[model samples]
Target chain A: MTETTIAAPERSRRANLLRTQEGVLFVVLVAIIIGLSLLSDRFLTVNNLLNQTRLFTETALLALPMTLIIISGGIDLSVGSMLAWSAVMLGFSWQLVGLPLPLAVLICLLTGLLGGVINGLLIAYVRVPPLIATLATLAIYRGFSFGISQARSARGFPEEFAFWGQGQVGPFPTQFVILVVLIVIAHLVLSRTGFGRWVYAIGNNEVAARYSGIPVERVKFTLYAASGLMAGLAAFIFTSRVTTTRADAATGLELDVIAAVVLGGTSIFGGSGSIIGTVLGLLIITLLRNGLLLTGVKGDATFMVIGLVLILAVLINNLVRRR
Target chain B: MATQAGRLTQAHRQRGLFAQQEAVIAAAILVMTFVVSLANPDFFSATNLLDIAVNTAYIAVAAAGMTMVIVSGNIDISVGSMLGVCATIAGELARNGTPIPIAFLAAVAAGGLIGAINGALVAYARIPAIVVTLGMLSILRGGLILVTQGRWIESLPEEFFFSQRSTLGVPNPIWVMIAVTILVGLFMKYHRFGRAIYAVGGNAEAARLAGIDPRRVYMFVFVMNGLLVGLAAVLYASRFTAIQSNAGQGFELAVISGAVVGGVSILGGTGTVIGALLGSLLISLIGTASIFLKVSPFWLQAVQGGLILLTVLVDVVRRRRRA
Candidate 1:
């Protein structure tokens, strides 16, 4: 039965870059970039490249932890909600409560941590499935943000705070620099640490990992907390960029994050993926959005393109794997 | 008597479990109604109660299909987007002078086609159900918006309002909801194909060995889910004066919450249509209770989220105790 499953002929792994999922993604990413550059004269400019990176910084930050979580065979659907909630808190603490900028930022981070802790407790201790637990929290957190803000928008942050998102260092956005640093740290942690191995073990088989003394619950708690922290960080960056905080901020963002992770050749069922692949997936998605927009795909058509990319990316990956 | 209970068949035990769960939800609804009526005598108004029922009928119909999908060990979050697409197709066709039945059929057919695509990808391509449906969700929503240019289809024909009217003193939507629920419930309880759905969900390898085609089951359940979404789309049109591009946003989450809160195990193989209906009722009751208690609508989501967590927590405890 297992042998019957693979209908495609096997290929030598060493012979072709196209044989590997990541390699295939890399090739596709390059092709898209080349194709876009050919189609649009503005696409090849350094300014546009930097702008694209800046635009994607929040999603890039969110994707790092999401890649880890999905690799660990769990999902957190509440990250977008968490980001919204934390952004609201950030604005409220600064503008409403008259707190110092640093303190308000701390509160935003802590709010995200608290939200993650609740999710962790529900899943790790209470034994609820991550999907259901996070879905509940998604609504809960969104509702809290809306309730507190009274469905209003908060804007006009101090210029110094906005600098975090809008400032440039040698032609690169500060947000871009921050995201790069975080990505390096995440890649190291995923590839060079025992925790990373344990994550793979847990995703592959939770019962076996627990029996192997892997401290599964603690790892889960930390991963979820880290995801929330990233969301808080993203909240800061996103709010700084928009210079506004609203209840509906980052709505549908979870989709982009998940699409990137899955398109990165990560198994949605968990246990195998790479940060590099995720970055590549992110680049592909960002390029698709940028390229489509540059090519004049209006409003919802851009979404259709992204959606098609998501499905076709995975479908193509699966087809490649069968060989 | 205790021995007699112990000696009951497996089917009887399953029935007993279903009854116990339904009883809990029913009892909760009763208490909620009682508390709300005490807070505001207007809660007992027939018109308000019937309004809740009408609002719930749409969700309940979708939940019925969701229950089957979940019980078959798959999920279709694309139902919300599917509803949007179906609504537009039906609405536009009706506005273009197509007969109601043909328009309805076209909408259902469109839904079925999308579901088939989703099912084929998951079952044949072997992509994960969540990922497939998530991608489809984006694709359908984007496609709908593109086709309609983000415009709300207004001024639908008078015949299109048929579902809004009363038939034998009951709203057509409520009647449709009841008929669908009963038919699905009976099908789940006594039909061989229905039993196959449970069997495949319970253990696909075992079901395959016992001569059931799990792929066919997956495809069947998804198509059925889409058909229900198509039907619910018509009811959705009747409720609103115009159908916007974002008509059914976040709808899948609500339906899934109802199924989860209704005792349908996300792990599959143990759910009933009656439980799904009751779960919808419980959710509707919560909404009504919030209104009577004068809670802000913003807090309603938090309350519903809390209830979902509460129900899942109860289920977890019950399962652990059983073990």
Candidate 2:
């Protein structure tokens, strides 16, 4: 009771730390950075690094909540659609309703939260499976986006609004700054809050968590809402950067976000993950794309390289874990 | 004891009744087909029906394999991309004067190799099926692009086109579909290996205890899926007379949707070849109907999304009532 039990916990904790999938991901990230730097002089340049960081900001923002949701054992297949829908809402609020820029941003985020809440309620409370529920919402939200936007793009936003996407703080892009702040906030919420503990507990074992008096449903619901909120924020940055909003904006983006999260060592079955790993994962993805572009890879070939890297990363992670 | 026995018998009868309820979905599908035919006289034309069958054949074949894979508790979103890769290989071979049979074999083998990689990662490496396959999707697409240098290969030998051409008063693609359906149906119903798939899907832990290697079973399913997808790719390339990296873009959604509508559960462990075939037919008909009914082509994705949602809802309701 004195020595054996105390030593057991410490040993297991160390094992957990060493055995994490993120350990492999971190190694892969470092390896890729080194390899790419060697492969291309441009890859290590400060300008390219900044561009890579900016490129990843929107995707990283979306992946933060996605990490939480997946950790809770659910998926948000609708995030891509949610991004488009949120953007459309923001566009409408700005161009049609003539709302203030801040108010438009608020509405966009609110729309995303509402979408996430609906997904959460349906999956958590109504007992619908996550994939199906989110798949449905993906269509609904995308359809709504198209309906509202009439399959057209909304553009010509105020300069101040677009500044969020393009402006920089010191040497860092605004989007990059936004992503860093968001990641910090997310890291705090996930690591320090009771809600975070509940999420992990629920993902590990929902019945046991429920039996232990945790509000499993509420936590799950809030996680999904958080996912939506992040998606909304992503839309803001994506549209701002692109300087246009279309119904099909962010089409197929959910897969990329999910891929990054998974590559970052997040388990699809949920229960354990970290925002830091996701941040690294996003950086790895951005770097891969940028490096490929610098190397003159184009179109689908770039996707192929990224895909190979993802498979190799996960495979190595799995092999390491087994050993 | 007598009261308990009576209650048990009542419960058994209730279960039997519920099993019969699934047939209602089949009936609904039939009724819809009839109504659709009534709405458009052209729909009942033998030529149009044949067109539908021919169009459905490739997807149906792929969906058959996908159904088994999904029922065994995995997925292959890369089928679309795999198809693209396979088609490129076959087209490249055929263009170089390879015999049709050998080219077809080469394509299928290429797909199988890709699938084997997926199998290795998911089974031996213990990676999640979705992430592995999602990566495969991109990898295959990228490989295809690199191989063709983003150019469409439009020239193929005349024999390559014969697969889509009619023979014996039946479209060759439809004939291939039928042959595949019969063979797969027989295999699923009687083969020991096939039975293992159901056992694994039904309960992996129990199957493992019963001496089945769930990983091996999953490997077989993934490989078989890849082979079937290759076959589909052959048909696709033959029909279109062109192979490009983007040829199978969004094909995964169509095939998965077909499987879902055919009564395959996305969660896996339940589905049928016949159901998948029917689901393929339903989906094919929808696409055809959209064209015949002059609905905007833009709405195709939205409508398909709606149908997927409806199918999942039906599955959920059926499962709930059974419980």
User: Which number leads on TM-score?
Assistant: 1
Give lDDT per model, in order: 0.86, 0.82
CAPRI quality of model 1: medium
Against the true structure, candidate 2 has what lDDT? 0.82
* Model 2 per-residue lDDT at B174: 94
Task: Point out where model 2 deviates above 4 Å.
Answer: A1-24, A92-104, A147-150, B1-22
Q: Ten-residue segment with the worst summed lDDT in candidate 1 chain B?
A: B1-10
Q: Which lDDT tens digits does candidate 2 get at residues B1-323?
A: 23223534654666553353236456756776687788887877899889989989989889988988898889888998888888888888899888889998999998889889888888888888998999988887777777788788876777789666788899899998998888887888779888788778877887888899999999999999988998998888889767765788878877887888777777766677887888778777777887777776666666777777777776676667655
Report the number of the highest-DockQ candidate: 1
Give the best candidate by lDDT.
1
DockQ of each candidate's interface versus the true one?
A: 0.70, 0.53
DockQ for candidate 1, C-alpha atoms: 0.70
lDDT at residue A160 of model 2 (Cα atoms): 77
lDDT, candidate 1, residue B203?
80
